[model samples]
Target: MDWVVKFARSSIGAKAVVALTGAGLVGFVVAHLLGNLQLFAGPEQFNNYAHGLKSLGPLLWAARLGLLGMFVLHIGMAIRLQSMNKAARPVSYQSKKAQASTLASRSMLLGGVTLLLFVLFHLAHYTLGVVDPQFLEYKTAEGWHDAYKMTVIGFQSAPVAGLYIAAMAGLAMHLGHGVSSMFQTLGLNHPRYRPLIRGIGPALAALIFLGFVSIPIAVQLGIISLQGGA
Candidate 1:
């Protein structure tokens, strides 16, 4: 167990864990964005999509729990690494220049923590019954929450939609740094394709952010309504 902890704390090993987890999360975001995209198709389509997920019953919950666990572990490691880095900054270096890290990279750790806070609020508003819920009783035939209707209701609020946009913005900031770093951590930073890594990372992050944020923006713009449509 001691050696396990030590290995996890090592720079290379820590980066390996971060890279693997970050890559997995990118895949998840893609799927989620695709699913959410149905809102543009209309309510019936979006509802049907949500309903389909609920139909999976225990299987859906199991998948959610597994993903939640992985998310927690990934976040914990990130927080740990960030803390270590902050602590290592010399105390007596009073005249130190403050321009070492690019703003995006320097603040990703902070944005991640803020994003975590947003997630909790989001789950409560849209999923859990803890907060002012979007749909009180979207119960499925198998007693699962009617996730489709709930999603529609939650995004109906102009304010909520705006906040979601902000949260996705934060997600983009984190991913902008994360994607390229992940490839580097995984030893994929070949000199021949370094440009590819740099270019693709921001592009992918932009797509993910834009896809997720668009639904809310469209709703707020009145270009679409979530009420009776998907």
Candidate 2:
């Protein structure tokens, strides 16, 4: 137990923890995107999917709790590592160079913070329905939560759609650097596979970004909407 605590406090261990937790988060993101993509299948299919998850009862809550734990650990470790790095270099550099760093890597902290804010807002808007309580009251013919209608109506607002698009862009930027960094920290970025590993991050990020943003964009363009308005 003592050794566990000490290792967790160590830099190498911290990075490993971040990498592991980040992988978990990435899995959740991809899974979530896939489920959300069912929206294109129409209301019946989408509502059934949402209801099926909710029908899990305790299992669903347990999964949510596990995800929350991962989020807390990942954010806490990142902040600790940042503090450690700053403490090690107390003096500002006379001049800084980013010749080898990509913009995604350079802005990781900012992008992460942006995504955090967006996540909170997203939960409030959709998960809790606080942002639009009326949407939660929507029910399908089968009495299941009308998530499809809620989503379409919610994204109909220009402000909501714009915010969603911007947040997804930030998410893409964060994932772009975080994925490759995770691979490196996990000792999977061998020279032979470095290019492929590095490319995976950006490619996955771009796909996720497009997938998520397409929903709101489609709604805004009237491509995805209620049969004849909410």
Candidate 3:
């Protein structure tokens, strides 16, 4: 297991985790966005999807546990790598040439930590079903469960809106730096296609930020209302 541990601690391994997690999240975003479009369709469509997810029984829990494990591994590798890099750079360099690029351009470690906090807050707000209990009070026709209500009410608070939006911005910054960097680490970097990959990375990140932020905006704007007052 010595070689396995060595590989797990390597830079390429850490990046491979990021790439895989980010790619997995891409699918998550698609499903979430599609379900959210039910906002236009009315509550039945959206709430039913929410109930269905809960009803997935052991399989749903399995998926959550699996994702959590990947998330933990990703964070652990990141911390280890950052510590190793800092050890390598104990002395400060005094020139622009000493550093390869802009702080934002070269600071994925910092960005990753910021993104980590954002993810916890996100799970608290949306996934844990506990961030805003008042929001969860909304119900569906099945009387099975009504999750969309909680969302509407939760973002009605200005503090929640501000916090959620700030998290999304952090996520955008993190993704902008992470995407192509992961590609390069995996040996997929090519002189010819580098520019294209780099260009598209930010666009994908922007879409993620905007899509997530849109729900809160809609609620704050009164475009979507909770089913009833608590």
Q: What is the C-alpha RMSD of each candidate to the true structure, in Å?
A: 3.2, 2.3, 3.3
Superior candidate under lDDT, 2 versus 3 = 2
**Model 2: per-residue Cα lDDT over 1-230, one tens digit each:** 99999999999889999999999999999999999888887888889999999999999999999999999999999989878876887776453453345344458888889989999999999999999899889999999899999999999999999999999999999999899999999999789999999999899999999999988988898877787321
168-194 per-residue lDDT for model 1 (tens digits) = 888888888889878888889999999
Candidate 1 regions exceeding 4 Å error are 1-5, 87-98, 138-148, 226-230
Candidate 2 weakest lDDT stretch, 10 residues: 95-104
Candidate with better lDDT, 1 vs 3 = 1
Per-model TM against the reference? 0.84, 0.94, 0.84
lDDT scores of the candidates, listed in order: 0.76, 0.90, 0.71
Shift in Å, residue 173, candidate 3 = 0.5
Winning model by TM-score: 2
- List candidate 3 segments past 4 Å from native: 26-30, 95-102, 105-110, 126-137, 227-230
Best by lDDT: 2
